[model samples]
Target: MELTINVDETTRNGSLLFKAARTNDTGAMKKLLESSDVDPFIRGNLEETILHTALLNDNKDVMEVIVEMVPSLINEPMTSEMYKGETPLHIAILKQDINMVHYLLQHGADPIHARAIGSCFIPGPYGQCYYGEYVLSFAACLENEEIVTLLLKHGAPLQAQDSLGNTVLHVLVLQPDKEMACFMYDIVTSFVTNKQKHKVQSIENSNGYTPLKLAAAEGDTQMFNYLVQKQKRTYWTMGTISYCVYDLTHIDTWGDHKSVLDIITSSKKMQVRKLVDIRPVKELLHHKWKTFGLKYFMLWMISYIAYTSIFTAVCLYRPLKRMPDNQTDNFTVMIQKTLAESYRTKGDYIRLSGELFTIVGAVVILASEVPYLARIGPRNFFGNASIGGPFPLLMVAFSFSIFIAVIFRLLGMEQESIPLSVALIIGWCNTIYFARGFRMLGQFSIMIQKIIFGDLLQWCCLLFISIIAFSSALYILFQTLDLTNYPYFRDFQMTLYTAVELMMGLIDFPIPYNNVTPSFIYIVYVLYMIFAYLLMLNLLIAMMDDTYWRVAQEREELWKVQIAATILLLEKRIPKFLRHRSGVPGITLGFNDDDKWYFGVEEIIPEEKGKIQAGGIHMAKSVGWEVIRSNLARIANMKEYTESTPF
Candidate 1:
């Protein structure tokens, strides 16, 4: 007779032979665990293996059977079940089951296996995995001597931090009970070796708190003495970072601004351990000093000479004072005599000087850009160029225009005056350019604002369409009415101009009121006011406000790029000798191949064989780029939703 007793437990979720351990049946559990057909170590829906349940029921016979069968299960952390992500050893220690803990440890369990992969519950930075819930951290939290010793002898790391950034020492200092405090002190004295002391004690967790600082904050005097007696080195390696707490006296209890020494010692009056690096600022200053001192001075000398001479020529022109045909004065005679003294004939000296300086300014523009322009195509010139590309060229054109305008007017030749329009444009462009030099008032932000011009252009197109709609209606009305005397609405061009200007309350309606108006015309006027001024105007304002906020979010990165561009442009104007040298005064920090911080932002070194070699994770910025890209995608999806949705 075949004894066919069903040994496997079955449910709707799946079945395992873990039920053999439920009745504390060692022989049945051993047979199931060793059976070729039955997988006794399989975890269930709650991520509970048979070993976890057996440990809860204090079945040492079942626990040993499973450990002897499935050795990998010794280090496998539980996921989402009771005691989430805790290895069997951690749970055994927590329960004070010394034998079970030793059984798992002796089976080659990982001493530093913090948690299972892909089972993180604590949120950290994107593209990074945070391994929280260290077993040592857990055992130290229990503050038992045996548990602590067991994990330490197995070579558990003291540096592994939990979800809240608490180290093993951080957890140890929290136990203030006299008996437990001694146990915690013994744990600290056991493993903290000499070379690792400064590194271990001074390591600041995410909250900028060291173990000593945490103990001080908790007011644990015994733990404080335990740390101080061992921490012989008083001084700390100092640097200015966002989070570092030093001498506790002067600093506030909580902030990224204080140092570790600021948190523990009572003498907060002591100067903080400082590591200041100012090589960048020093180099920038030296570059500016020499650049402005030599090359910039030469450019300005020519520019000022042209500006003053051209200005004086215009100021001395007779047209400015409106000199009459019969008018005669000693002032005119004296001006003529002054010109004669410098020349062989009348107007020769003034003309020559005006042309000379214009040529000087024109040459300055060409000299500054021709070398760069020769190397790259015009498309690249515009693409990689800053705002108002080839701008000095415009200044050159303006100078030459004035020179031409003066000659034409002096010779009594009939021609269009170029100086008036060109001078105004050149002056305004210069004002915009100088704004880059002094961005204190943020007036030059248009340079940065130019990047999101596409978004702004889309908004302009919407406003333009609205304007065209309102103007078209008005054009039809006034054109049909044949209102000849109404200059503001005489044609579609004038009508469109008035339609835009009317929204701002610049143009009053009911024009040509002296004559009688049709009733339909008045009706059209009211509708135009409602649609154009009331509705469309407000809609346009909302779009502009939204655009400004989007632009404002990325302003810092935009400014950084603009600053880099401006530095490049300025560097081109001066020679290498006049620029900064590393050994110059105040330039203490070495400028070597390792230092790639030239663009005003740190360079990113991608992960090389799974190691972050840099001091910081280099940011690829404008936090708003990711934000705006997602928003644009979301908006695009919104359009599809509108198209698909039922009205």
Candidate 2:
């Protein structure tokens, strides 16, 4: 009869072979492997290999013993559901056991191809393992240069990507260790050939982030600079005139068609603060605006002018109306009178032309918004008021008003003028949208809009409350007085009107001495002035001043955000054939053989090429880099090179 050997629950599920492996009991492991019932390769509940179980207890001797008994277990992977595809080498590197790692590599362990894709490596809510899924990546993440060098020496492929398509360099940026990232970046660049380096640098991960682009998204400036420096090739350096060609594909859009700019300029994520504060990104945008943005903006402006002018002409040249004879004329008779008078008027040709053009303009403006609505999604298009400015909202109102006015005019309703007046006001105000084309005017326009919506809106709320309070108090105080004594305060409506007029400095003293006490009336008048004019008005001025300085500081960045939005919107309107007709901005960076659709080149003088560390991140300062892009030859003679400089 066989009696069960009761073991501690801690000893790997009480399996004798696993227990022997964990405790470094080579004799027990040998006896267990020899048993017909016990298989050395049998996986327990967690599916850990015997080698894996020995490594867990740092039992290199047990690992060697097991390997000698069943040499196949040396490279055997953990076939468990949770830790599938994890090899002994991957376990050694993760354990940071350099001796074990050496032993595994010496025994012909597959370092490059064997990916550890266990539950431990997958990112999730509880915690994340940011390292790529390979032994080389695991060693690099640990920053154990000895193990990394050993793995590389043992012929680990430098260009290998893990389960998420992230190369070791891509994984380094996502880690919080900047020094390790920089050190590994230097190592990778030095070890690889130029062609291999470009492949490693430009290959985007599953989330569409290259190593450099990932650094930008992670806001790791030091790592970003180190990566940027590695990719740059000094084309010609003659004293002060040095032209270094950067790989435009470094910052180019990834497989998802999302560029570095798209990630950094996201308002919802507030990533502008993360990366746009860097100098190269700013110059890149400035270069893009100069190259193709100015022309598109001018076209949008000219179209807007025509749109507004047509609507204005329609209102200005409306047919003249004759007054109805009696004030109490029936609605049908009034409509007939208005139609007859409008038909009898001269200048019918001008009126008809204006009306036709106005209809076309309103329809065009309404239709143009559909693209913007679709591109940004309804939440962002409506929520982010700064992007579209007030123009989108005003255009919508103006279009609706124009449609209503046109319908009323056709129906012979005299109220057509009411909606027309609203459209005319909104149409003129909508011109502020074009102000963004000019730098100074654009920032100033943003400031004014900010003040109106922020400070002025709050002031209006306070003003309303004060008015209602004072108006009620004064109405009750002056109720017994006759109209002859205090006509402005005799009724509740009149009292409210008088209160508003007093606030505006449009009314004089109107306190009556008949019913209300002179002192109380005087006190009320003084209190109204103090609360509404002195306090509220002055507070509004101070609030505006605060908003002005605040907006002034961020005006340039704010203006650039609007410009980015403009570029995205304008590109949507351009026909793809015409957009790609000139080989200007688009070029093939030979890394992946894919043409970069959005990119720019930065030119920097050698004297100003030194890197500046900003908030512990390296960036360029002092007119860092002036970005320029045109035909490939004019920017850089080589099609393979795309440049981004220090600043």
Which candidate has the top score in TM-score?
A: 2
TM-score of each: 0.41, 0.68
Model 2: how far residue 339 lies from native, Å: 6.8
Query: Candidate 1, residue 35: CA error in Å?
Result: 4.4
Clashing pairs in 2: 246-642, 246-643, 247-642, 248-642
In candidate 1 the C-alpha lDDT for residue 414 amounts to 32
Whole-model lDDT per candidate: 0.51, 0.69
255-346: candidate 1 lDDT, tens digit per residue: 22233223322211111111001222223333333444335644654565557557556434423223444665634422122222334545
lDDT for 445 (candidate 2): 77
Instruction: Count residue pairs with overlapping backbones in model 1.
Output: 12
| Model 2 TM-score (2 dp) | 0.68
Stretch of 10 with least lDDT, candidate 2: 614-623
